[model samples]
Target: MPKNALGAAGPAVLALVLGLWGITREDSMWRDEAATWMAAGRSPAGLRHLLDHADVVHGCYYLLMHGLFEVFGPGLVTLRLPSVLATACAAAATAATGRRLAGPWAGLLAGTAFVLMPSTQRYAQEGRSYALVVAAVAVATWLLVTLAQDRPAARAATWRWVGYAGAMLVAALLNWFSLLALLAHAVTVLRAGRLGAGRLPRHWATAAAVVVTGALPLVLVSRAQARQVAWIPPLTWATAPAPLCLLGTGLLCGLLLRRRPGAPARTAAPAVSVVWAGLPLLAVPVLALLAASLIKPLYIDRYVLYANVGLGLLLGAALAVVVRSWRPFTALFLAASAALLPLHLGLRTPQSRVDDVLAPADAVARVSRAGDGVLFIPSLRRDTAEVSPQLFAGLDDVALVRSPADSGTLRGVEAAPARIREAMLAERRILVVGDPEDHPGGPGDATKRRVLAAFFVRCADAETRGRRVQVYERGTSCSSTPARRL
Candidate 1:
């Protein structure tokens, strides 16, 4: 195969193989993915209602997966396959971008770097829109590069402009934060002197305007649902360094590549352009989010995950420059593979997740009998049950008034305080799933703990990763039931 084809094909194959290696591990789904599964499981109308009330930004992705589920049926492999495929496309597109800007060697290196990055491997095997966003941004960037190189007098420039517009539109729809990529593209155009009185600027402006117009409604709706990001804490100086280091490393690598021995003298300019093409994409989104976070906490690293594509390209170019001969390049690749062996193995284990819902689910399944009652302290621990509904299928949720699917919400609705107390008093053997620290807090949580203390005996308490399971038996041995409030 030609070097050009190898540049694209090699990275794609690596990404696919890496993505599928542990695609169906026994690890339980985290809350965000559980939310994806929950949203995708809903009927079209129910999902639409869910978007109107919450998580409007993810509406497009959920709808896409909903259609996929209709054919494949819901499972971990099916849930994550789209992300894996999208990551492969992103790897191919990254290679093409590097090939366009520099040479086939740079393309191959950049594509390999993309597949090797820990973040790339992490999200590629998980069900989410970030991988798709990365792919769309990469393809759009490649098209923009093509537009920049085209002769102004050529008739083909118009079609290229239309394609760029469509790609940008798809990217923005996937994740609203992807719109930040336009700022990066704008920097590239300005640096290339394409923003003046020329066809390039005119076409570029028209495409950007259309994308913003089309995305306006989603922006408005998602803003109304801003509570969805309330978990994001205010930014501090600590949050600034990691992204700065990443962007700085990419720029530094590009500089090193530009000055490398045996590199073509004429290639200096393209190396600079590679840095310009990538730096803004890596920096602008992070800076914008940091600024916004001063007002309301909106910054999170994964929100701008596509910026890593630029880092991968710059790193690839640097690698190509340092290892000018194929022998050293091969050695470097082999060394990286050996070093990543441990991380690769760890990714397949349940310990990799924020919380392993499976361990707690399995614990509950082992002890609980038919007709046993289940309760979630602080209510949100219900996410465990959502992840493995089959394990929880036999236990009745004593406090749940509406199922997540029925309520069209991420966490199901809870019954009123009176109904919860009544239900708790009636159960003979109740199993409570919660974090240990979530005890005896808030109106509902306090009420549930108080009722359990007053009317039950602690039979067993088991601690799993990030969760606690306690079994309570009906008895007076714990504490006397307090007088009921009318």
Candidate 2:
């Protein structure tokens, strides 16, 4: 294979292997992915209603997944395969961009490093829009590099700009956080302008404007649903370490360049371009979000996952500097893989996520009897049963007023507190599905627990995979009714 092909194909193939290794996580699905599965299974009207009410930012991704589910049917593979393919494409784009700015060796290494990163492996198997957003941004970044270096005139340049804009628009539609990539690209374009790439910066501005304009409506609508991000914690010393570690590693790799980024020497120009491109992409988006988070607390490492491509490029460039021989490079890569083996293995397990959304079903099956009333504290735990409705088949959902699809919401709408109390009182036996014992549930959950405690006594309790299933019998005292086996 040609060096360019090797650079692009090697990392892509590796990404696929890693992504597919445990794509199903032994047939487990977490809550976030459960959200995707439920949304994708909805009818067009239901999906439109969902957008009107919540998750408008994920509207495009949900629709795309809906199409895939329509054809493939909603299995774990169908739900997660697109993310794997998107991650592979992102690895290819990252390699191509590094190759354009540095060389084939650097590009290949960068791509390899990206595939090995834990974040890439984690999201590559998730059924979400983040991986797709990364792919779009990586492709757009590669196109920007081509335009800067080739400096193609007239039609060719126009076509590249068009591709760039389209790629960026797709990313923005998938997740508006991806728009941060343009900030990194703008720095790259300014560097190109400094290097006498006339008209390129102006062309980039036009392409960026088009992308922003196209995604403006989504931006406005998603903003209206701002409560969707209400769970994101405020930035503080606790949240500072992760991004700092990532940015610190990138800086360390950059030091390996051992040259001024603005060097004007003909042979050193590529190195300068690589540094300018990779460093900004590595630093800017993360820093911008961190600064913004100080005001509103929106910083999440996953939100800026595309920045890992920049780190990969820098690591590749640094590795290329020392590992002139393929044998040494292979040895070093193998050593790094060995060090990450445990983490990679962990990513494929059901325990990797916060909670296995399907795990509660087994416990529910064990404790529930025909006609028993089921109630989910905090409501969203309804996802646990939704993904495995068969196990919950005989149980009555006592508080649900409307299904998620019927309500146009992620979680089904529940009855008012008074109505919920009235409904629960009618049941002789009720099953309480809740988060882990340590979880401090919201006021609504507290109210539900208080109501349950007033009339029902716990007969049995079981916790598995981050969920708690408690069997309750009517009567404040459990002394009369024997405690049931778990």
Candidate 3:
């Protein structure tokens, strides 16, 4: 009700969010987190080399976290804190914008939703760019609204344009996926008079420049990336459902809230905001389905968290609109969120699919020696093996040794099969964990059988919650070559 109370509560909500996200997630970092940690180690120059050449992640977020870790303590907390803070900042920004659009009460409501919304809370805990990207997109939208408010005096208008342009630039730097946010913004504003006439033309010109600058790196990298184009099929529709759900629900809620009576704004402005936030989340799935029809490989959900923010904010707003004076509504929201606390603290948190070992990982962690090198043989199942780094922490090295070339330290990428054989040549003791994919036991599948056979004379099998672990010792009986025993 009061300005003082809203301002005070903003940080409190943010603190509650950060507390939930940060303190408990220290036990396990998911696959994408591992990927970020792995990427954070690259020299800034090395990252530039990777980015100037290979830009799927768009290079900027990794490089920023790389610097943050240098200052923060190079631990899980350090890797994750920036993102946690970013999510909070995004929530705070959403509140500020809500305050601008509606009033302090509305701002507080929206901000609270941004922080406490389950999906937002879940991602804020992760060591990835989604949280930071969420914040940036929020800030960019806020700035867009500021521009649309149109303080036409030269200085204010110029400043609004500057803030708008700068926020767009930073958002692009954070996540290329935010490109969808930018496209959505451009579309909504244009449809309204927000970007109409001379203003619209200039805005388009500036936006075109911003997009070109942002996409230049991607276009260049995508060229040489033809070698990896085979992996692009994962972008298809059959596999696109998760992202669609992520973005669509968020957009739907935001639109629903933004359009409600007493929503404290004209329909057109909030409509534009909803459209801005929703389009990319909406389009990527469509594109993925198209790609899936054409090819068939590469789809995932975590990054879709960026699209979820608008939804979360809108959902919060919708809840506020409906339950304005209802204690039960507030209690229901708080109670449902609070109930997730135990899972959040436990290693069993749902994101563990990306963060830790399911059953098989626990099996290996339990039975295998720290010195045992575990290989998820089929390799490249990033989520399934998401728990590997955490399980092997200070214990063993895990790799996708699809081949011999992966022996020694090749980071986490799959190594050539021959290189692995050569690297393990001298080890008097070796343990190989085989993947089921390598042994489908089908026609003309002797090569797969031979690889498995060569690695084991004895198969020691173990089982954990969701996975099966089988250990193999070298044996001559299964191979014509009579491989040496350890």
Candidate 4:
């Protein structure tokens, strides 16, 4: 291939990436993302306060983004650029891996497949580390495969291993659970018997040493923070682990896993195949079981995004091996995946839908005219990312009740009855949510039921994909007089 041709692949694909990124830019932040922004925005001292009192599972990611916001500033675009850049680089990396192991066709298909997976595109569009983690995972895995396959070790292989180790370390720093992917990679390498037995032990010892040395402090800190954390429930076939994993994996890697190679590497077909099919399948269950024992039961699909690229490349590899003459069918498959890109962006990319966890604006629209006075029930704030901003920061009138946050329309309420009454009286209409009744006082689920029904008139009732948000109007009192004007 001409050097110019190789160079063309990058910018050619980058154009598509730049365009696709624009389409997913306005996606509303889900609960975790919103909280991430809020937490990272706090001053260094305030962040320390948050770590001691709030979720510390990803304090490093928070700190990194804090630095990022210093350079790029905040809001949806500034926040999500990392994921977008990570995914775009992953696409380029996928192409390079393919071109290295197979050929130009393989590289193109692999990159295309990467951008098409609903999950890949979805995470790429979010303001979190999942996309970056997955990209690092792919780049690292490719380097590891390059290392293992070297009959006569080249500088490339050493650089690849060095890169792989560094990538794994960065991923661990961003989100520790990503260690599961690296662990699975190690296991797959072990199971394949590729690294001579003695070499294998040495290789693993280094990996273990790195993971323990790097991740140990974060793990210890997380233990202390767990006391204040809520219990994450177990996974089911449906939603425990993200449902996207099953569907995306099936669409992307299922065929490649079971298929036998009919053709040779277009560029190392055999070993790369092992990394593709095995790591993700092993990583998911391994993490689930391990987490069940030590941490609160939990599974989030985005955590394993590195596996998605492996699947995409394998999918590319399978096509390369099997579809020797079926050019038209290959075109069709690629086109269909590309065509679905908009749908994924529209609904899944930002994790959006009619029934998304309440939009921050919904909380804003309610309190916009209340002289910017926003009062949010802290209990409800815990429910989703929109909790703090949408509920209170919709405008300048934001206040926190049942919360330690000082800058708000109301304060020191402690979910107290007198306080709820006071914020309601001071603001136009207090938009209480989640367990509305339980905060101030209640016998059970019905605790705040009567009060909400009695005073707050139902303005809107709606549900989508199971997330439900109801708007209520408090009957006109002197407190609500200004709201009527709104």
The best candidate in terms of lDDT: 2
Please identify model 1 stretches exceeding 4 Å from their true place: 152-155, 194-198, 258-272, 325-330, 439-441, 476-486
lDDT of 1 by residue, 1-486 (tens): 127689888999999999999887575666577788888988999998788778889999999999998999988888899989989998998887777666777788889898888888888988888899888888888787766654435568777777888888888898889899998888877776643324555667889999999888889878888888887888778877887788788779867765762333123333226666777777778778778889999888888889888888788777777666555766867798789979987886666767666678889998788999999987878888887889997788999999877777777889888889999989998999988576555677788988998888887787786678988889854233332211
Q: Provide C-alpha RMSD values for all models, in order.
A: 4.4, 2.6, 6.4, 5.5
Question: Could you tell me every candidate's TM-score relative to the true structure?
Answer: 0.91, 0.94, 0.72, 0.75
Q: Which regions of candidate 3 deviate over 4 angstroms?
A: 2-12, 15-26, 45-58, 150-152, 194-201, 204-208, 226-260, 263-299, 325-328, 335-351, 355-376, 379-428, 433-455, 462-470, 475-486
Model 4 residue-pair collision total: 9
Top-TM-score structure, candidate number: 2
lDDT of 3 at 33: 67
Report how far residue 449 has shifted in candidate 1, in Å. 2.1
| Whole-model Cα lDDT of every candidate shown, in order | 0.80, 0.85, 0.55, 0.56
Predicted structure 3: clash tally = 29
RMSD of 1: 4.4
Predicted candidate 2 versus true structure: per-residue lDDT over 363-418, tens digit per residue: 88876789999989779999987788899997899989998888899889888777
How far is 164's C-alpha from truth in model 2 (Å)? 0.5
Error of 4 at 414 (Å): 3.3
lDDT of 3 by residue, 385-431 (tens): 44344765543333344321122111335545554554444332334
